[model samples]
Target chain A: MPKPERIDPTDARLLLALTEHPRATTVALAEQSGLSRNTVQARLASLDGGAKLRSFERRVDPTALGYPLTAFVTTQVTQRRLDQVAEALAAVPEVLQVHGLSGETDLLVHVVATDADDLYRVAGQILGIPGVERTNTALVMRQLVDYRLTPLLRRAAEQ
Target chain B: MPKPERIDPTDARLLLALTEHPRATTVALAEQSGLSRNTVQARLASLDGGAKLRSFERRVDPTALGYPLTAFVTTQVTQRRLDQVAEALAAVPEVLQVHGLSGETDLLVHVVATDADDLYRVAGQILGIPGVERTNTALVMRQLVDYRLTPLLRRAAEQ
Candidate 1:
């Protein structure tokens, strides 16, 4: 991770506005955030150029793309071949997110598939990786709260 | 979930272009997708209105907002009080995502905080939720692969 980039209240307001209306024009954002159009534009440019904001692609829903099933697989891997295991896991298209974790689990993998049968194949592919000792897979039945940051942005803006 | 909306090859290409250049203008998207400007506009509108595409807010990094620590908590809950548990978990600002899961665990919560001590408090708050039986928390040491969708988008376009 890079050094934490400090965002002022103005920037937080801009981000919060964008969170509500992502495709809003500069004029609209200015109106919503109560910031000058020029200020909004400059802040957006800085946030985008500085790598503080991620690309829009990260928001794409796999379920919308036909992969409705989501699962988390915790894998224990052979320590010596960790790098190889990570590389292999990266090659699997169904694997959306992978994290090296502290404690009993070596890796936590987030996966999505079109259906249950496809998920079986995807999990098998993950286990087939040479360094993977074993995997405990849990199917996500329902997402009560999807990934969100609106509350944080609101608090930041208020401060 | 709504009926899965079918996206044609053109839509896939348009999404792929957006994945690579999220801030690209309509003209740029039209050029990259090899579609007419009007077609690009229509496709984008359809995707957005249908809720197939997510807003840029989903891409915001909690770490960038001063919450550097990431942890996954698997919570076991009493079956009948699932809704109450979900509601309580949603009240926690640090809890980014909560998913009802199959198998032994009843819920999977993704959380973020400023530091280890903050994470401790967040976990305790989760445990404090009524009907939450027990929670197994694991701190994410390193994100080998963050959430992504380009690979799937590219494959969909190719097909």
Candidate 2:
């Protein structure tokens, strides 16, 4: 993870406006933030250039699309095969998000499968991967929230 | 809860492409799709208008930035307090996402806090809110994979 880029008050204001509405044009962003369109445009370009801002995106429902199985898989890798295990796990297309973590779980994996049968296939397949110590899985009974960069960006904007 | 808005293969393809690279111009989409840029643009316009392609955004990490604690708070509200509960939960600035889900959990909530202490305090504070029943939380230790929208969108473009 890289360091969070420094931002100004105006950048903060821009972030807030965008989190609620990511696609607001310069004109709209400026109008909402009380800045001129040009200024907003310039700042947007600069912020993006500075890596403080990235692209915008929409939120979609994965389940609605027939991917009914979602789970968070925590892995405890053997001391010898940790790196290899992470690499193999990261290779899967079905795995949505992977992160290295602390505590009993060295890595956490989130995967989406078409159904329980699909999930079973994935688990069976992954269990055979080299160096995997153990796995704990939590099937999502429901997805309260999936992913959105906006909220954190908005919070950063607030600061 | 609403119908999974009748979406088709072409629409899904378009979404997958845009979700992968929202900045990809209509010309590229046209080239990739063997369609006209004007047509691609037009379809995108309709999707945008319909709130299908609301906005594009990148999902970042809160833990990487020092907010290490993450939890999913499962909430249930009586019929009478449904609206009240939803509204109150949404008001909590720390609440990143609030959603209605299936199975035993009626609602799912995602929250980010600086640490366990912060998470505890925030969860307790939220419980203090009227109509919030006992909350169950599972702290995330790590992320193994993020099946983000972008990659799926990219695959759609390739097809």
Of candidate 2 chain B, the 10-residue stretch with the lowest lDDT total is: B51-60
Q: What TM value does model 1 have?
A: 0.96
TM-scores, in order shown?
0.96, 0.69
What lDDT does candidate 2 reach at residue B117? 90
Clash count for each candidate, listed in order shown? 0, 20
lDDT of 1 by residue, A14-124 (tens): 888887877789999999999899988899888887756876677777877878899999899998888888899889989998999996348999999999999999999
The Cα error of candidate 2 at residue A85, in Å, is 1.8
CA lDDT, every prediction? Answer: 0.85, 0.63
lDDT, candidate 1, equals 0.85
Residue B145's lDDT within candidate 2 is 44
